[model samples]
Target: MKKVLATTMATLLFGLSFPVNTFALPDNDVSANSQVLEKVSLPNGGDSSQSEAGADNKAKEDTIAKKIEGKLEAKDITVWQNDTVNWKDGVKLKEDNAEFKNYLEEASVTDLDNRNTNNSNTDTNDDRAFKGKLKITFKDKSVIEIADQKLYVTSKMTNINNSKAPKNAVDVKLQLGEGVKDSNGTIGQKDNPVEYGSYRIKPGVNILNEEHPQIKNSLFNLVKLQVSDPEKYVDPQWSSGSANKKDFVVSKDNNIFTATASKLFTMTFKFVGYDRDSRKSIEFDKLPQAIKDKLPQEQKIKEGEAFEPNKFEDTIKENSGEIKYEWKFKDWNPTKSVSVSENKNFEGIWTRSKIEENPNPEVKPGPGKEEDKKERPEKENKPKDNSKAEDKKEIPEKENKPKDNSKAEDKKEKPQEENKPKDNSRVEDNKNNKKSNNTFPRIKSNENKSSSNKVYTRTSTKETKKESKTENLSKTPKYTLTINSGEYEVLINGQVIKRQMDVKPLIKNDRLMLPLRSLAEMIGAKVEWDPQTRTAIFTNKGLVAKIQIDGNEIVLSNGKVIKMDSKPLNINGRILLPISNVANVFGLTNGNTKDGIDQNIEWDGDNKTVEINLNK
Candidate 1:
């Protein structure tokens, strides 16, 4: 049968100490009729019958006195017995019955007092009921106090046939039972229970099993021996007779129990490319094997929980390589030290095609290998005498023909020159002459001039000219500009020029022409348009550049002039200047161009893009 083992063991283990009154009671008063019981006799039989009857009567009275001893040991209690009396001498007994009754009452009260005094002495030397508070403390800083708790100790009979079974086969354990409750209610029950594995019974025995030897002993002896002789027949070996008899009592020095609860948190890692595409994510379990191997076993944080911030170091390092399948982020790179905060997500940005290198470039034949091969035989086998005569004859003929052709060509070029305005053509011719002589021509501005009668003169000075040329070279700044044809966009030093222009930059006559004002501003220069003169002037840091509408010549602050093959044009009300010319005049080229300037510019014909890296 299932039974709840009482908390008797708990009381023993806890050793609840209860305060009992130790003061002694005064002696009871001896009655004047105390000799009456000695004279009383049995009504029937001989002397043997009367003696047996008195012995039986005395034994019954002693049992009654012992039962009420704990209750009436004090001095001022009244005792009264009212039962039909049996007497052999009816006349004599009736007269002396009052004395006998008083005597019996006095003896019974005195006997109870004596018994209590003796029992108190024995209890002082033996173990008594434990009465105190049972305290249960939890790991969560919770405490429970049970007041007036009792600890019962008892033993069971096992190995029935063995004579020593009562002593050796007894199992002693403690039980707190339903009596143990905290402020929240019962501790080890369905509604309110201790944390799993937190509660424990003493002697390491399962208290829930009713048949457990100790539990059986406690239950049977304490519950079954109700009418039996507890002192002699109860489980004396396990009963709480003395301190030594109790097995499950908690040690007075350390009476606390301990236990733990579970906690949990989350972390996420995300990988993204430069353009925000090629995205991937990893959770604790979804992490790559390489990353998982390097990570601490305990690094797997629970979802929605908190963890140490540095736990992902090794894992990030192991997976760093995987982030760059063939590309990386230009601005941000993932590192081993990258960490995700508790409950936070981390993302790494990478890029593709940011840096590229051609592995095997094609090697082309140098200069004129084929031409040299074809001309080598001609050099060895030509007729020397005939070749000399032919050279002499052809030389004079070629010279005389060019002279006649020059006269005709000069006449033919005269009309073209004459067709242009006189002042402009004369200035152009002077500019050309200065260019041929490797000198920059300066314009002598007319101090006395009429708007309609504009005149121009050329001036040159050795010292002033040299200073002007040097000033142009020194004041210009270096920068890079990338422009795409058919797209009205420009990148200056990797930064896009924000202004929008009506016309896009394009390639014309092998020269790039872009919006004059935008290009000027992009290079930290200012542009002013003069409608009257149809001229656009660009100036930066005291250096000035002037380009007239449909004019092929550019004028600088030092009056140094640069001639462009393509003249400036006004498109959509915006002057478009030849970029190659402007770059040259400003000394912005890297000297790689074919004619007017070095070809510091790279032309991607396929994409129609012009890239200029100017190093001034």
Candidate 2:
């Protein structure tokens, strides 16, 4: 039966005038008719099918060589960061998978589908594979190649093994996402590359999965790209640590772009100093070395990492050689502790001590004056007389006075001179007293005046001594707070404040709020709570503020009602006020970036600390 079928098939083929080599034979079939047909199809009975196949291949190569060359030519392919591309996509070919297979079938000499299974020793291009080098030139003037995968059907054109395309697309993309690269390879319309941005990569396609192995992770600048505009721009600096450029690669030549997708992102934290009053930047170099050493160092933290700012003294005594004052560190402008998602700067707010003349000026002693002061007791002792017999002391000398007979007779005859109130005698007595005591003349008639002078001298000396004591008492006390287990303890000038409470600091709407009574009293403010109204009245530095629990409006003594970003909270019978809001009324400030108001509330949220600068 098989022989008859073979003969009948040959006869039919012959009748149609079909060439024997034109129709291939089944490898499994072998019969007498087939052998005869084979001989008739070729001269000299040679294996002519191979030659015929070679002829057909030669003809096909001639017809489609230009198309193949075009495919080999570099194409300008724009792909999103971390997106993958195949040979077809790289050549800017519009053909789909089916269309690409058809093209290969028409151009290829051998059966490409069975070539792998049959293991034929055929030329690589003849088996429907891409040939020739794909040179990829990048913006940085670097060059690379797309490794040949031996089959052009679905092989990825990337820089994985030997190819020179970037291991990550971000290394070459002008922007982060989808966009058209102009002829000059610029991504956006901006004149500068730094301002360039791109649209987000199409979701579900570029996502890292089994289907898309080229994309290692999500792109970094997705948010920046989404909010970009022609006028508004996002910085495209790939090296600020937003994206990892270690294994980045990209190349474009002739129009071909070969890039793989990989980029990692992380956020950074830095400490900056700012003037609390002016809200101006303070040069870190200008800060005292002591303060600089105490500040938190800059650090790089990945997203969702735990970050806590270190603590610093609220008031630091600073000396500028010629002057002495203090730099009071305040709370950060924005926040102290944050969950890192973007680049953040935790600026330290500071207030300078008020410049004032020294209350007690030193009276520098002169050389002679110092000696005189030392010898004052000796000189005073020398003037002390032992005898209390006032009259006997001087009367003995006056008893024998002026016994001249002739002078006495003249005085008796001139009764007018004798009756002249004895002025001469008193004058001589006073002159003798002055010589003995080295004293200013006393008015014998005004005894109260002399006594009052002595009292005034003593009073003035006492007052001076009292003022010195008062100055010592007026020194501002330093405070340190320790918060743990939702409770806090205070150390004022190294002495515990003795007031303890179980209240934790609250963060609401990005603003820090705390218990008012402790902070107010520490800063020398008197706090009074009204149970009926749930209000706290604060009196400090001549300003009064009445704040109600769970309310945003603050009624000040000056008759102004100000609304706060966050209201006062009542937690566990303790009233907590928004420190940033009421900082002003209590002679404190927690600087406002929007209003340009600098603050002096020394708060470190990371350590759960609040420092009071009484001097401010």
RMSD of each: 34.1, 23.9
Which 10-residue window in model 2 sums to the lowest lDDT?
253-262
Clash list (residue pairs), candidate 2: 75-255, 75-256, 76-255, 82-261, 137-252, 166-249, 589-599, 589-600, 591-599
Residues 1-616, model 2: lDDT tens digits: 5444555566664665444554545656575333433434444555545556677677655543333333332342333333333434343333445643455433312222221212211212134443333443333333334433343322122322222222223222333222223323534332233333221222223221324333332233222333133222222223321243332232221111212111112333344454423335567777777667666656655443334456455777777777665677754423322224445555565555434344322234457645644554334332332232233345535565655544444533453463333443332334346455434433332343323322212113234445344233235543445445444443222223223443776678977676775556556777776656867788876888888876778899899998888877766545677776777665566533244432345666667665554543
Worst 10 residues of 1 by lDDT: 112-121
Predictions in order: lDDT: 0.38, 0.45
TM-scores, one per candidate: 0.21, 0.24
On residues 522-572, what C-alpha lDDT tens digit does candidate 1 reach at each position? Answer: 355666766568787887768888888666998888968888978776665
- Whole-model lDDT, candidate 2? 0.45
